[model samples]
Target chain A: MSTTRLARTGGPRPAAAAGRGRSLWRTVRASGWSYAYLAPFVVLTAAFVVYPIFASLGYTFYDWDGIGEPSDFVGLANFKQVATDGYFWRALGNSALYTLVLVPVQLVLALVLALVLNNPRLRGSTFYRALYFLPAITSIAIVGIVLKLMLANFGDAVSKPFLKLGLTDEPLQFLGSPHLSMWTVIAIGIWNTLGYNMIYFLAGLQTIPKDQYEAAQIDGAGRFAQFVHVTIPGLRNVGLVIVFLAIVGSLQVFDLVMVLTGGGPFYSSDVITTYIYREAFGQVGTGVAVEPHIGLASAASFLFGLLLLVVTSGQMLAIRRLRARKEGK
Target chain B: MTELKGARARRGLTHLVLLAIGFAYVYPFLWAVGSSLKTKIDFLDGGLGLLPSRPVWENYAQAWREASFGTYFVNTLVISVTTVAFTLLFTAMAGYALARHTFPGKKIILGVILATYLLPHGYTIVPIYDLINSLGLLNTLTSVILAQVGGGLVFGTFMFMAYFSTLPRELEEAARVDGAGFNTLFFRVMLPVSKPMMATLGLFTFISSWNNFFLPLVFTLGRPELRTVGVGLYAFTNQTTTDWTLLCAGAVISLAPIVVVFVVAQRYIVEAIAGAVKA
Candidate 1:
């Protein structure tokens, strides 16, 4: 890329021309090739990622049935409806609960597991890793089916026995009840992600050199004290990355939730993405199925996308602040 | 006597916890596998044991035949293999570009790739559908392939770039002096030397593509013929809610490729993840 630019600019000092010209021609040739190489990614992203983001914004203002017709430009009406919408609020709340609950619990569990598994004396370490990380790679399709069976109600092979044995009056309608469905979604999300994030924590744990622990030990610090005094502080960046990233990821959650409960017996389990899908594809308005409210769905998606951007940017800013405080330049 | 007693108590407790947790993880898999083998009554019975009295291997055949999964199997295999190969080539090339070249726009390009992953595909599904449909490519294997190639390329590029940034540059420089062009040097020198990175990257790409649930879901749009394994598996269960034996068999069958990859490339995958952590 540079070679082409250099050649286009025409010359250098006369003495260095022969050598530098070859370099310039080479640079120009490489530049042409570089753009050619990079073109496909650029085109795909522009077509797919970049255009969709902008189109989503444009779509938010218009009532267009997904299949056909000229879109009706509805102005800010769709956005206003979302502001007072009950189901929209519930979806937002469920999504928030996932972020607020699942991310923290998952992070803590991951940290503790990483610490335990990072123990140099630990045996069967590889086996433990494979066991734990299996879910990270396991199909969420299969996860949904297995978890559904485990979490089923009456006549369920597993849950029925527990209910029969007087575990509870009735098996908890996990996917049915509005109250439990969100938490169930959150729990599954956490389980799906725990291994991948824990590996990051383990990495962070490894970076806290043996010397720091040795230093603390020499100073008569106990293991727990050393963990608090050194390890927690040491993992700040990794924590920020995992936690912030987890929040963004959890908000984007779709597949397993869709599988476990088609946004539920009620609208209880509805999340932004599921809500978007339902609006676009399912009961659109109030009659048989809801009328396809493409505008409302688009508006909700934009708001949801904005919420993610704000949270991530906030975390990034906090990270910068933390780093500044540490360096104190 | 006291020290020994304390040691034994702690050991017992540790093993007990491991055993309990082990059961939680292992039982689901066993149950899934077990369900595939059982008759409808036994499956419904949900016995504590994984063993099937009859051990019906015919469920596998039935599932394979019933779902028309053989067609989807070919679709999936083609998509995954081709996607992985294309992902491998492009990502490595791009990774090499970003890693070796002190080029303008490198950082910006990397940032764009990373950010693409962050934006949920759920948000982009509509326009991508629109875009694909406009091109009259709806429900084509190419649409699924393109969706994956597009989606998978971002992370694949990022991961490879992360690994490649640390690769030794001395060889590239020497190859340049040997009067080699960029292609020859990359092919003969740097590419050959990036064996470990290529393996792990390929494993990573294949696994993601193999198990990708979403891309094919929306793009397939009810086309039975064009579905990949993941979406095809979904269609199987959705259509036949009662016949879970066949469904579970399909589940096990779909997972076979990934399990094989994991077994073979287990060590490299671990080290690569571990290496990323340290970096």
Candidate 2:
């Protein structure tokens, strides 16, 4: 609807409306009003959004701490350093691992939950849905911090329960151990985000015609077969939305890590954003201290941004191609 | 008859699994709320327990007073309210204009807006931080509000455009025939008709700005007084790592408003989130 309106409004001027000179003046006057209406959006986007993107790119080329103007023009040095930086690569790899694991797991969990809750005969679905989604609305920083406290050394709440259940003899350093920290972060991530995805899938599922299932049932399809044929196909668009968002969101994971581990256990849990933050803002007490490298941070962010764009676009294209092929078949 | 019995069995099992998962999902917040009411020693003892032995309500007061959560709450309110207000105003204006009229460079502007939606703020945050510093707005609520509103505008505009496009053109045409100007047409005609969409976007923006951590953490790094609840809780826990009772209390305090708002406006929230998939 909006695009059609946009096209209608933006279409070529009617040929017989007026003389050329007067029509040009009318067009100019109309544009003036439109620009007047859009001035705040334009100015704010230019100042805040557009400027920052180009500025960050420009900052990547020069050696300047975040405080001052760039005096030393070190061409590609920041890029070169980032190229060889193990921590930067590690951060990217960790983010990749997170996106890889979290997206599909979150989607499956969300789909299952959505399907279960979508049943018309289910009792207390509203309460259960609200309960499950409570964490989705809370501050992630607070959740991460509270979770860390709950899961603290052996006598802590989470650890005590695990020990009592005979899951382990000692406290599991979920956020403390390097190996477990990232996965713990991923788990908390999935837990917090699962409901949001569930909502998406539920919305998608609600749009499917109920008679499709009725048709399948009449054709002797079992529940599982109906789910596979009717429900999964119905959810494709919603699944794509979740996948795209999950990829973008996972790449930008910072708040949880900042509060939970601060990329601790020797930078083992660092995502690109945390790594960039420490590089730009300087983290202390984390055992991986480097002088605040604003230039390199900017470079790393820019490079990562490019990589994310490429990955996202590539995935979108792949989805498109697959859909096209499916339609063709 | 056996098939009917099997269906009943399946339904019972489904409820069992749902209830169990719901408990696991909600236990953390419940634990935090329960722990917040405990003294330090009691907290450690009953940390995982749903009920506190002695509910020390004063823990809330302690967190409120000592942690300066009052200031953080005010700061967050100021930031979220201002950000949401500006986001609604600017995006609505932009959306109405883009929807109702065409101008030179409209395509370019729309393309840029769409691109901004895809571009994560994390990548450009360094320069944004620098930009705020250069403007002398660092460590101020204004800086965070400005950035939040700015970051929120594109999506808000997108939402507004989608809604405004669907609105009947006859209303605007009638207003124009009555000799109403652009301001009257928009402020009087369009704004009144667009309340539902506005509410959805306003809640969306408010919740996000309220929960925003990373930007405020950057902007208010030096000024603790300017910290929002998210950043304040972060700073609080960092300083008082051993005070689980107080920290948990602070967490509950910060989470309380959100929970209440969420419960009250869950329909709107769910609708907005679900609608986001379409956008």
Best by lDDT: 2
Q: Model 1 - which docking category?
A: acceptable
Best by DockQ: 2
Candidate 2: give the clashing pairs.
Answer: none
Fraction of true A-B contacts recovered by candidate 2: 0.65
Tens-digit lDDT string for candidate 1 (B1-279): 999899778866765676677667656677778888999888766555577888998898887787776777788899888888887887777776666654445557877776776555447677777778888898887887787777666766677677766766666667777888767866898788888778887887788888777777777766888877767766665552547777778777777777777767777776677665454
Worst window of 10 by summed lDDT in candidate 1 chain B:
B98-107
Q: Write the per-residue lDDT of candidate 2 for residues A1-329, one digit (tens) a residue.
A: 23234446666655675586676566656567678889999888888888887888888888987656888899999999999999999998999998899999998898888988999999888888888888888888888888887777323556767889998888778988897899999999999888888888888999899999999999999989998999988877777777888888888888888898898778889999899989998884344456888899999988988887886777678778878988899
Q: Work out the TM-score per prediction.
A: 0.89, 0.94
List, for all models, the DockQ compared with the true complex. Answer: 0.41, 0.60
lDDT of each: 0.74, 0.84
Model 1 chain A is weakest, by summed lDDT over 10 consecutive residues, at A4-13
Task: Name the TM-score of candidate 1.
Answer: 0.89
Model 2 / residue A79 / CA error / Å: 0.7
